[model samples]
Target: MILCDIGNTYIHFCDKYRIWKNLPTNIDKKNLQADIYYISVNPENEKKLLKAHKNSYNIAKIIELDTPYEGLGVDRKAACLGIDDGVIVDAGSAITIDIMHAGRHRGGYILPGLASYFRAYKQISPALDKQINFGISLDEIPLDTQTAISFGTLKSIVSCIKETIGGKKAYFTGGDGKFLAKFFEQSIYNEMLVFNGMQLSIERALKKYEEKK
Candidate 1:
């Protein structure tokens, strides 16, 4: 079986052996002949995939998460499903930090991602446009302008996440997940977290179907 997580920019696919991604326009039915279970945040991409694959199932419909947060994105819900007691952090185009305990979502917040911060700085002033130095130390004050900006942005996010977690384990995923996970003492970097959640949802749906039959 194939599991797909369609984002705004890329369509990620995971099979039993490996994972890969393709642009929505680049997807070929010849490469994806197996049954696909998917969750999508991009409606246009979702429609394209649905049209191409007759065996595809949208697992978002089958997933049932215990969260009261209104208009929670399907991707966020999927990332939180696999963790019963931990802070889930997905550091993609946007950073989403969610707290889950006892199989229920307590609350969460969103923050500008690494790229977003860079963009914001660039918009404010061309001189302030600098890429984030992911390796910059948060312990000492920065002297250079680039370091100063990086320190400020990284420190704010790291400190907030640390405080919010309150010593709970953190589960990090997405493009920049590993970079952010390094700041936490108790954290895991799992690239396949959303896929794991999708697999769980698929299994649950299949079991329900069989029971009904």
Candidate 2:
């Protein structure tokens, strides 16, 4: 199985073995042999992916996960699928903090990701843009305006997550998840959480198929 988490910035893929790889969302598609399970947040990229798949294979089916949250992305559904109660923090182009309690999604908060924040800061203040880089030590105090922005943004995000989670399990994922994980003592990092959710969805679909027969 090939599971694809197609977001605005990157397309995260995992094969049956659970090896994950990522590519720019705008990249041209290549051929795929296995069954494709995908969750795409970008409509334009989704269209491109579907068109490319149509031209590539005949036997493999493309399955899109059905999300329960009205406006939540499929990747979030995948992250929280097996959990009866927990908080999911995905740090990519944006940071999403979603809660699942007693099988119900309690919604989440969306904020600019670290890189996105830095990029926006630079764009807004091009004079300081060249000086500010997102790669700063978590323990380091801000020595300059650029460092202050980077550290301050990260601390703000971490503080928010800490307050919301309380004592519940937390799952951290996405491009910058590992970095953010350092701030949380209990947060577990799962790069394949979304793929696992896809697999769970497949199992449910299969069970439904069997019941109909």
Index of the highest-lDDT prediction: 1
Q: Please give, for residues 162-185, the per-residue lDDT of candidate 1 as tens digits.
A: 999897999999988999999998
The candidate that wins on TM-score is 1
Please list all clashing residue pairs in model 1, or write none if there are none. none
Q: Relative to the unseen true structure, what is the Cα RMSD of model 2?
A: 3.7
Taking the tens digit of each residue's C-alpha lDDT, what string does model 2 give over 35-112?
667777877766666765653221113233334557666677677777778898888889899898887787787888
Model 2: colliding residue pairs:
none
